[model samples]
Target: MFDEGVIKFSCEWQKTEPLAFSGLETLMGWRDRIFAAGLIGLYPNGIGYGNISLKLTDSSFIISGTQTGHLLHTEPQHYTLVDRWDIDRNSLHCTGPIKASSESLTHAAVYTLDSTIQAIVHGHSAALWQQYLNVLPTTRASVPYGTPAMAYEMGRLFQEEGLAQKRCLVMAGHEDGLLAFGETLEQAATTLLALKQL
Candidate 1:
């Protein structure tokens, strides 16, 4: 049986200042909508953990910032735009008042795998996650979130499970973690919600 005592990956992250500036107004708008829907909001237990991202260009994407203690309440100034990346090296370049989400590298890996993806939604919902666990492509449970290994695991999914065509993933390692991406913000967000209906 699997044991939580046997944690497999590190949680440490490497953060840096962005070398380029990218606006986040649109990203924020989508975030507000998602937050209001509770897709990335605080629970009755006073806990919240989730993120969203928007592809900026060929080499960058903007992701929601860290410790969003209250996803729905965080201002646009708190969002982060990753202007550059070196996922293989677990390095990132971005600018904003707050740092990138811990899953920034994982998001970067997705973008690196498919240039066509323009938006991403990372939500946490246990019921939807378990209900569709077998229906969607998933990462191994041994790989933890926000680390280089987790990032590579995401890239591996794209290669082995037709993720380029799927544009979504259920992270087996991270409890309740689900990911969806598409050519536009609406598409990605829709995909995420569609998972729950499945």
Candidate 2:
């Protein structure tokens, strides 16, 4: 359930049709790859983190569902798929076993910033995030993830600073939070992967 300053989306999409994306298979493949690399799973104490997404339309995308936890490394059936997440008003608008990624709004803002961005890969790595500050554009140190403020920051990065060209940023306030985006799943995934090689 995502909160908009106007209204929450928890109950608005109660009864929804299944929305599918042509890139579902590829997105899942990338999710698994990131999971295998320990980029989209849990921490040492067991708190889960990270998510992945693929654009479906100008306003919609497919994302890994919420509370995914370690299930990300398990079977494909255990991996929940979220479709038709609307960023304009903040809602899933689709019926699924799991909820949309808590960071759906952030992803939506990226698509809104550039229709050319077809994929987004988000992960947590304190070491990598810290190292990439000089290599990437980053958000302010007070913005929280999954909120409208973060979305607006993303827009500011693109509109004012032209972050769309780089398509990556570190959520300074959201611990270890790092995000990469591109014209395809591989491009976004590779951005995060590039940090590993660094």
lDDT digits (tens) for residues 20-91 of candidate 2: 547667777888888877778776665677888877777667677665646645333333344455554555
The per-residue C-alpha lDDT of model 1 at residue 68 equals 73
Clashing pairs in 2: none
Model 1 misses residue 27 by how many Å?
1.9
In terms of lDDT, the poorest run of 10 residues in model 1 is: 1-10
Name the regions of candidate 2 deviating beyond 4 angstroms.
Answer: 1-20, 72-92
List the candidate 1 regions with Cα displacement exceeding 4 Å.
Answer: 1-23, 43-47
Model 2 C-alpha RMSD vs. true structure (Å) is 4.3
- TM for every model, in the order presented, reads 0.82, 0.82
Question: Per-residue CA lDDT of candidate 1, range 96-155, in tens?
Answer: 656777778878888887788889988877887797675789989888877788888977
